[model samples]
Target: MKRFLVAPLVVALAAVTLAVLPGSPAAAALIDARVGALTFRPDAPGTGARRLASASVRQDLYLDRVSGTFVLDAEPVAGTTSYLRVTFGHLDAGRSCQGDLELRTDTTSPSNGFTRSGRTLRLVATERRFGYQDWDCAFAVLDLDTNGDASDGSVRSVLIGELTDVPARPVLAVTGVQLLDARALRLVRGVWTTIEVTVANRGRADAARVVLRGSGRGVQVRPTPVGVVRDDDDTTVQVRVRLTGKRATTLRLTASGGGATASRSVRVARAKAPARPRPGTYRSADGDTTFSVSGGKIRGFRVRTTTRCGGYPDIPTTTYNTYSFRTVGVPRNGIVVAKEKGRLYTARLQLRIAGGKVTQGRFSYAGPAACFAVERFTASRRR
Candidate 1:
């Protein structure tokens, strides 16, 4: 949709007399104005008679006895389109003025449908069409004989008004509720499962201010009162719940708004804990290094390396460095944390494994005389 702002030019008028005034003597002191009951009736000839649907209008203006201006704005309702006309009555009393206005986003000067007779002004902004549903128009009335400065006129009356098309009533339905991860359907006790609830609006008009709610035994739902669901649209509400009981359980979720409601359920079963990796040797992609785990604990690392020294064999020589690690925390979330110590250095390592394989590992070491090194490796279990 196109969006534009319409601001009316201020009118400064030199005093002039008029035979008829719009409202009353009090109209001169009026500083505010408003439009009431702005409505639109589809003028399309032939598709069964339809009720007049109300369209929203918003206006901003400065008014007084001698001069004023107003900007009216609105967006046409979705679906049907017809001639949308706006009429203002008893506006800016005791002033003789003219208006130049345009509808939609047309850049040319507005040439038709703006007229003032007695106390009322009427304008047919545009014929509503597809992709041209939004409109903003400015209306200004100035005293007849201002010598070019708008602020010189006596303060008259100001009118700001808005017309909004009411969206059709909404019908809410709970489309589905499923675990974010299919594997999480069988939930383990003491663990959290993430699920999503799909809410759909099956109505022609937009739905406003919908609230979603969920309930179940032995479960805690985070983020209650899910936000709104629009018309002919669907929104997913994410819920994270921790199951405390071991047996099977069901979760019920409901979406309610605009005098309509829907509900759905998800069933979860108690499952055994995931199995830990077997304690064995795992070799890196390169054959020069290997890691070993025993009794669910990471124990040792062996690396083949070449070093250069002046007094060794008078050249670079190959050597083997083997370091033993002391296992620390029990495995959790597929990770094992441990510490390795050597005569002159100490190191901390974290190893991550999944599906019976050591996917990656890292270690950091510090030694005397400020020696330090950090390394990472990826490995798989030996066949």
Candidate 2:
């Protein structure tokens, strides 16, 4: 919020680029608009009529799920403004005059008009007739056909229409993902996260009708389905990717939409290493070892793994606790259980072979409990 109480030393209306708007069909495409925030024009200084010193314009578009409407957001780039005429949509009722986009704007001025420049200047409407800038001319464009144009006229700020020729998309980018196990990528069981897919208009021409698809074998969509809320939106879908079957080894995801295609992979398994060996539990980042026999002594050992990486910058990184074993062999057979505050966290089994290096795992937790796996696994082997 830019406050201009004590007249700004100078009053200047930062430049404004009134170009095309969002939710528009295929066309030459309008260059985004620029908001000149906190403009101070000394000559036309702050007053009851013109008091905007400078300001910025931020334009964003989104597809509304409830209203099935396209929403555009215009924010000041630098500072506050006295008035802003956002061009989002215009309709020519009965073709009486140049169609004017009915937009909702929070402005500083009560009197103003929407204008445009072309072969012949046209006046959409004066602010006097329509006190509120927002107009709902739903029936106006009912018969208007936008073969290659999505607007009623050359855009000054906003425009909207239907797409006649579906566009050709070139690239599908995986900007972000949620509910995926960090290391294996298999869907983390019982969790929901957001996944983002950014589809760039790659071809020489613009494309429309963009969609994103994700699926896998037995890899059920995790009871969480994903879809496109809007093309340029940062948050796309909330997905719950889960790998429930221990027998199933893999989960595959594919995204297709906007004339482009992409794929991602996730491997599922017991979320951690083995969990027993009471005083002899230990684990490594990666690699599955059969057994560790030190000096012909079969030291019973179980390895485990976990994660807690998602945290604020101020949060401390999770630390790995190690558990030392007595001898190089498997401890007594027992259900390797890990508990936190009386809550059953994970369970694993310890199995060692005679005259051979064989180790069987019991359990491994994947979240905060994962950090203490080794220390707990080693504690189970206390004689």
Candidate 3:
């Protein structure tokens, strides 16, 4: 098995186009929040609070996962301070929130209050509550929905001072993808292969509903769903893929969840061709039964029976007989049917051939009382 380490590549969050909502104050106009790099807000959204310092908002956001940390550096305001209110003007319909807003605060001077509505999240750091200013806060949007959907986007990050969207440090990363059988065996063309993907949760909080999917040219891979990855731990999931091409190809894999997404790509060599089975003589363990194969056809077959026939136990005086027959070309499934007839009896033979050998055969005889009723046997090629 060959494993490919996947560097955590930050997938850009889906771009959202925003138009200024009617009647909103000029300073608080709805704006597009494209967070991959650091975005600075120089002016506060409204009257009460000051804009956050440069690169103060760091956000890690996904379709259904979101989290971030913020430094709300501002002068003390006397009245009800509108510290931060996130306007999620980008979310689509049918998108609802789950998981309580987990906001960890570092300062006690100004008590914080969080509220969520249809598409807006408001964080209030009011002086009237605790008489504090200039604090640090971190939060994560635990679950976007009970079931994750790429069509929905949630709170990227909640900045306590200005209206900005950001994400937390990346959490779940696809550290490696292993071609389960690549090391010991070359992948055979048109054959299904199993691959294992490793995912690690590198953040403080647990990552939920992580799913991994793979893709490649002329190849097929099944998607794997990983429920959760606890903080600082890792897990592996197995997926089956089929290579259909003869030339080399690259397999791309992606792991996404918990407001984070990571991807990796691996190059796979051309698949090997199948080998044909050799033709030879095969015999049963007792040497009483034998089959001859040549040019993929059963050339000769024989079985000598000395046991019970139609419930007649073996005895010194029991009649013994040998039946022999020649068969035509073998079927694709390796089944052969032949018949032998005598003046007073008829014999039918059924044999299965596989892996250069004959196996699981049955012989049926119908005639006088001394005839053998049925016989079962197996045979392998002599090396």
TM-score of each: 0.31, 0.23, 0.33
Q: What lDDT score belongs to each candidate, Candidate 1 first?
A: 0.46, 0.31, 0.50
Over the stretch 1-383, how does candidate 2's per-residue lDDT look in tens digits?
A: 11111122111111222233577766534222111121212232223222222222222111110011211223222233323322322223321112244332223221223222211111233333333233221101111122313233311222222111122234445554432113434333332222323333323333334444556554455433334424334334435344444555565555555455556665544333233333322332243222354443445443434434445455645655322223322323221112223253433333332222233333334334333342112222212
The sequence of per-residue lDDT tens digits that candidate 1 reaches over residues 22-140 is: 66454323112223333212122212111222222333222111112122232222232222122222213423122322232111122244433222233433332311222222222
Residue-level lDDT for 186 in candidate 3? 37
lDDT of 3 by residue, 1-383 (tens): 11101111011111222223488555522222223222422111322123332222222222232323333344323432333322222222312111123332212132344443322333443233122111122212221222222123321222222224332343777777654213322345666655567899877566788888888897777888987888779997766666777777877888888777778777777544433335888889999888778787776777888644444365424567777775756644454555677899877776656676654677777776564556688888896
Query: Model 2, residue 275: displacement in angstroms?
Result: 12
The Cα error of candidate 1 at residue 262, in Å, is 1.8
Q: Which ranking of candidates, highest TM-score first?
A: 3, 1, 2
Instruction: Say which prediction, candidate 2 or candidate 3, comes out ahead on lDDT.
Output: 3
How much lDDT does candidate 2 score? 0.31
Ranking by lDDT: 3, 1, 2
Candidate 3 lDDT: 0.50
* Candidate 3 Cα deviation (angstroms), residue 231: 1.9
**Better candidate by TM-score, 1 or 3:** 3
